[model samples]
Target: MVEDYRTHPNLAKIKIVLVETSHPGNIGAVARAMKNMGLSQLVLVNPKEFPSQVASVRASGAADVLNDAQVVASLDDAIADCQVVVGASARMRKVSWPQLDVRQTAQLAMETVSADAQAQVAILFGREDSGLSNAEMDKCHYLAHIPTNPTYSSLNIAAAVQVFVYEFLMATDIKSVHQAEGYRHQLASAEQLEGFYDHLYQALQDIAFLDPSKNARFMRRMRRLFNRSQLDVKEIDILRGILTAAQRQSNQLKTLTQDRD
Candidate 1:
């Protein structure tokens, strides 16, 4: 049974997600790549056009993946239950975020998924032209960068999927003694993490730290910072408690000032 399961490592964990794919051909190609690597979980978040004949033709023999693909309204919806999210990018952005090579990211993901039976790992690919936006990238716990020719680093979405999936499959084959021991820390659930962000945001608002007018930009940056940290459940709980305390203090201070006045 283990061998059978190992044969389809992608089936056990790992969701291949494409966000806002503009081309159906890329979608089909991604499906083909997933099928090639024994990956069946293909998720498309708001594709420009899906179920197109062009996609089917490009999919070649991987029509099953295309047919079974989950179409979600947003990237968050696609990876809501996922424990680990790795975004693929070819270019470096203005923001300095932690980066991982494909192999390292795969190893981390495999470790995460294997440790927790309920864990769902998501590998996200952005639009073909722009790649993953900063917002989309912020949603991921880690960033996976493919080492291509610097001059011509533009990789097709399907090609990017192939690289990551291949590494993931290879990582799964290795029976590590460490994996048997399980993860050292408990990673926060998506819901928990989101709640922490909410509390943190509210605390910032209460303290007048984040300008209400620029709240959107401020929250976006904060999200990216926290996501990159990949906080565990304990870490998130601790942070939430801290934020709660800060909010309470801020409220108390406001009350005292008003009473004094």
Candidate 2:
């Protein structure tokens, strides 16, 4: 039964979350959209209206999704196990945050989800009027923006969910085929990658290559490059080992110089 359910090429991780939704109709519509894309997990955090007849009617045949949907008190509780969180935002903000276009965000989600079986991925949609607040967006590791007309960028909540979920389903399908064919690359888990980054950063600091006084500007760029590359588990492990060896060599050299002096 598990194999049968997972045989679909588009199958991805769980926990699609909607936050602060004002309209039950939109919630139902969003559930329908998720089912269309073969996604089943749905979470609602502090919705304005739920269990409404309007939502059930709008869900049409996807009423099962609504019936099984989890209602949470807070966003943190909803996404606690998710390693990768993608927040959809229509408007740009003054403060800087990591952003990914829908396509790229979908790819990252697939990579992260497939890397570890236990890893959860979340796609967060905000309320209709304002979209995600800065605090809510900040909770996400990455921000996702859909490409739309500049003249009129107003997308309904259900519509936005449809666009993102479509991209996600497509990307997951393509990646799954490539993976089955042994043609796709793998990526390290966030925990593994973070450990590698820490070792690399420490090695660079020891060599004076990374200036401590500069406030990690260069380190951030290196992080971006790695994220774009999507290094696999083996790749990250190998790199971390190399960094460790280099650091050891540097320490040995320092000891030799001190003894000679």
Candidate 3:
């Protein structure tokens, strides 16, 4: 009873999020691994194959974690409530994120959850084959990587989950490092961020700045820049306001040009 009292609360604050997982067996193994380390609260984001015999068999004795796992449609939904989100990736991206070693990430998790008892932490794992997409990485506040041989860095999804969960369990002497202290507004949620992006894109189009045909990756690049900035709720509103003004001005200019012609 004393053991349960000590670990359960902290463990409850940490969410293990698997995004677009392809295999059922890996999901089962991940559940088993989390249970082994006194962690739970698994969230599956759009798993291709779930609730299969393969996964259930791989789960072995830790079926409860699998049974209780929450399934969500998108990565954003999976981590919408989390204040601190760390994504696991081995491959480097064009857009730089605050990179952290696995141990550092674990310590950050400890500090974040400790500082605000209500604080939620999400550790996101990408697909089994390709790892996390660039868009997915943009959603994270930090990107965590497990050190591996330069020649071969690929790790199975389940194995990767085990490594991070182990680090989280072993983490000690955690100290809070406060960032974004001066920012008045709270960090924007995934849904809020997406809305801002949509507004920006539409405004750019209305102003004849973004050519939809030729600018497929333009928004992705913009996402990288903003993701690094970690824009807050108030900041998002400010940007959207600028976009609305730009769009309105563009429409007025277009009407004047048509009348002149």
Candidate 4:
């Protein structure tokens, strides 16, 4: 039996995240789209306008989902608890992160949630005007791309979310996908990753490997790499310990060099 998306232990963990959305009506439409399927979780990051009359009117019968939506100040805050993050963008970038279509992404999300009930997956949609900035997308594990007509190929935020949400529900309904293979350990959350990345950046700078602050592209690639690895909590701790040791040794060497000079 298909459990309700709102209450399904694992399905409920999936969240739809929006970044810098401008139009309140679009938000309402998106809420309506989400409710069309069984999905209910919605997170808005720095929305221009929320609780607007325009949005409430557009939400129609989906007022419940709209009312329950979580609003946050930043993308990091919105997805702090999410273990898996997918950014849905119409543009294609053959860069660090692997690109997958909506169907594939939906399948991946389902598999991850099935593996661990407590694990959360966040599907992110960018702003209406410029889409997600590079810095914003740097935080994603995969780029969920939608192939559209070459002629006037832009999609409204609500429409895009609708397509992704529909595919997500279809992925769940078609067949019974078991929890990810060997899904024993819990994956690291976005918050933990942010902290680990900070530690790693400090360690690299300590040894003069490369200033992570100056090397935005390199750090993005690094994020993509570790994000792809799906590092668990223990793995993060191990890496942090290694980096701490390296930093200490690097500091000691620097002090000796200064003494010699």
Best by lDDT: 4
Question: Predicted candidate 1: what Cα RMSD to the true structure?
Answer: 3.1
TM-score of 4: 0.92
Total backbone collisions for each predicted model: 1, 0, 0, 0
Better of 1 and 2 by lDDT: 1
How do the residues 1-261 of candidate 4 rate in per-residue lDDT, one tens digit apiece? 444566555556779999989999999999999999878899999999998899999999999999999999999999999889999987886565778889988888877777666789999998899889888888898998888899989999899998998878777743324342444777899999999999988788778899546677778878988998989889999999999999899889989999999
lDDT of each: 0.81, 0.75, 0.81, 0.86
Candidates ranked, most accurate by TM-score first: 4, 1, 3, 2
Which digits, one per residue and each the tens of the lDDT, describe model 3 over residues 45-125? 999988789989999998999999999998888988776788998777666778888888888787666555566789999
TM for every model, in the order presented, reads 0.86, 0.66, 0.78, 0.92
Instruction: Give me the displacement of residue 191 in model 2, in angstroms.
Output: 13
Number of the candidate with higher lDDT, 3 or 4: 4
- Candidate 2 lDDT by residue in tens digits, 1-261: 122333553354756799989999999998898888778889999999888899999998998888889999998778866666778888876656688898887777776666555666788988888778866765566778887899998998889888887777777643334346564444455556567777888898777687667636676657656755656667887888888888899999999999999
Better of 2 and 4 by lDDT: 4
Q: How many clashes (backbone atoms < 3 Å, residues ≥3 apart in a chain or on different chains) does model 2 have?
A: 0
lDDT at position 81, candidate 1: 84
lDDT of 3 at 92: 71
